[model samples]
Structure formats: C-alpha cells, structure tokens
Target: MSDDVYTGGCGCGAVRYQAEGRPVAQLHCQCTHCRMRSGTGHASYLVFAGTEAVTLTGAVRVWSLKGDSGTDKHHAFCPVCGIPLYVTFAASPGITAIHPGSMDAPERFAPGFVTYGLRGLDWDRLDAGLTVFDAGPTG
Candidate 1:
C-alpha cells in the first residue's frame, strides 16, 4: 500500500473506506456534538481537503444536523454496527472529516490542535502544548 493511502472500516467490517494523500489537518474537538457522538469528552478527527480522493464501500446511513455555524453537517455511519465514520459539511463541500478511531492505523492520528476548547471538560485533559481554539479554525 502507498504511504499516502489510509484504510479502515467499521466494527462489524460491514463498512470500509480508503483515503489517499496526506490529511489537511488532525484535530481533537470538544464540542457537545462531538462528545455526544463519541460518548467521550472529545473526538479526534482527520480532515481532508477534498472527498475526491476518498472511496467508501458498504452500506452507510447518514444523519444530518445543523452545526454551530448554522450549516448542515451530515454524519455517515455504518448501518450494521452504528459506528460513526465520516462527515460532510454543506458549507465546505470539498472537505471531509473522518473519525480517527475508525482508521486502520489509529496511531496515525497526530492531533495538532484542539477545537471548542472552552467546552472541554476538566476531566478530559489534553496535551498542554497543543494550540486550542474556542471555535473551528478558519482558512
């Protein structure tokens, strides 16, 4: 496999995905939506600049919700195991965000910063060296 290629799937192995090239960003988010979806204090994500390089297989179910920016965010998950996979944004049609835990090599997740820092829980401490933002980073 090429070093630039990343592959992963759901818990039941029913849904799978492959993403090519380096991710645009890696981050940990403490937003209420992220925490609730992950069932944790935060959720890690690998953000890709475009979905053109991404290929998905198997059946997926999507749920749409209004994001903090008032844009629609569509979250895709496996219908079998109900594992959250990737997300698409109405405002940023070219971007895609994947759950780090769903990566075949989860260790590849190297978070560079934290988002929604103000919402972060005291018990869910993050790395002290990472830059944190009260909201999503702007390009």
Candidate 2:
C-alpha cells in the first residue's frame, strides 16, 4: 500500500475527514449490524490507525449497538445525508472503521477479505480469494 494519507467525506459533504496513515486492513463486512447500517448485503470497511490519525470536520450522528461479541459498536453517520461513515468497536478502541464508499476516491483501497461470512446474504458474491471467517478473527 502507498504511504499516503486518505481523505473522505459524507455523501452530502457535511462531514469530512482526513486519515493520515495507510490503512491496516480493508474488508467487506457481512455482519448483521453492518448489513442493517449500510442497508446492503455487505458493508465495505477500511481499518485506519486511530482517532488521532483522523481529523473530523462536521457533526456526526452516532448510534451505539452491541456486536455479536457483546461489545459496544459505535456507528457514525452524517446527519444531513444519512450516510454511514465510520464504526468503532469498543473492544478495539484504538482503531477506526471507515466506510469505503464515503471516501472521496474509494478505488484507492481494495478489500482484502470478507468477514462474518455466515451472516452474509446468499445472493452476495464475495471475493473468492479472500479469507472467509464465520466471525471476527482472533488475533
């Protein structure tokens, strides 16, 4: 991956942010929470460094939900446009999950894997080469 910063914004441009380091991982999440939040079969996410590496410029509406692991997951979205932007897991408090579609140029990052495959829609075809996991992988 390139050692360049990635910038992105909400659909209505009401919320903008700049992430200053290369992403650790990019993946398509098929968890139930993600599916509901994105209103799609899967949600594309890019894992960034931390909140310190990201600068936010607009008010974001946050919705906290419990993940399968019982951790509180905070989903942030642009109130004006109702576009999901990021998600933060209380378990992994340091990392930030950014929605690839919210980025100004999403093509810069490609999803490397598909997570929570068991909850994925039957009609959705994920990348065959990716490491499919029934749930989040243990580090």
Candidate 3:
C-alpha cells in the first residue's frame, strides 16, 4: 500500500476522519442508489481497503440501505452537518467508499473509472478516457 494519508471531515467539523495509504479506486458511480445517496446526479467514491486503514474521531448517524446489487450498504454521516462521509458494504468488509468531497484535499481525487455509465445523465459529462462500465463495476 502506498503511504499516502488523507485527513478530512464533515462540513460542520463534527465528524473527522483519517485514511492511510492510497485508495483502491477513485470513480464516479452513476447508479440510481448513488444518486439518491448523494442527492445528485452521481456520487464520487474513493475506495479503501479495510476499516483499519481509516480512523474516525467523531460520532456519526448511520443509515443502512441496500444498493442496486442487493448488497447491504451502511452510510455514516455527520448528524450535525448532515454531510455524508463513507459507506461500508457488507458484501466486502475490506472495502469502504469514502466521499472525496469530505477530503481535506478534494483536488487530490482523480477518478480513473466511471461506473454505471449507462444510467449516467447525459448532461453530466465524464472523462472519456476513463475505464467505464455499464450498470456497474465494483472494486
């Protein structure tokens, strides 16, 4: 794992987090579940391996739901600011999706892929060179 550490928090500073090592994947998910989760056209996700790589200093209100793949999705967000933080997929304990917008250096996130491209809104232009998958690609 790369020794690139990222520290960030919610908008209200009520939820702080630290992620060590490089992210497994940086991608844009345009699936329906992501749209609803992010309250937008799509969601930006930075995936990391294992919860051990992430440290949280504040409490969060969790919301449990199922993704389009029928896998359990647990989202932790700041109750005070109502800003989404990360998501844990029950199907893959080793992987967690952290919101790049919550990062101290949001500019550091460079999406290498685009998932659920078929469902992506036409108006939301994405990088044409990125590796893309239709209806999903998890990893």
The top-ranked prediction according to TM-score is: 1
Better of 2 and 3 by TM-score: 3
Q: Which candidate ranks first by lDDT, i.e. highest?
A: 1
Give the Cα-based TM-score of candidate 3 against the true structure. Answer: 0.93
Per residue, candidate 1 scores C-alpha lDDT tens digits across 1-139 of 7778889989999999999889988999988888888888998889887758678989899999987656788999999999999988989899889998999999989999998888899999999999999977641
Residue-level lDDT for 104 in candidate 1: 96
Give the C-alpha miss distance for residue 124 in model 1, angstroms: 0.8
lDDT tens digits, residues 37-103, model 2?
A: 7788988888987669778999999989888667888999999999888888888888898888888
Worst 10 residues of 1 by lDDT: 130-139
A best-first ranking of the candidates according to their lDDT comes to: 1, 3, 2
Estimate the TM-score of every prediction: 0.95, 0.92, 0.93
**lDDT by residue for model 3 over 44-100, one digit each (tens)?**
988999769889998999998878778888999999999999998888888878999
Model 1 CA deviation exceeding 4 Å by range: none
| lDDT values for all models | 0.88, 0.84, 0.87
RMSD of each: 1.4, 2.0, 2.2
Q: Judged by TM-score relative to the true structure, which candidate is superior, 1 or 2?
A: 1
List, in order, the clash count of every candidate structure: 0, 0, 0
Provide the lowest-lDDT 10-residue window in model 2. 130-139
Superposition-based RMSD of candidate 3 using all C-alpha atoms, in angstroms:
2.2
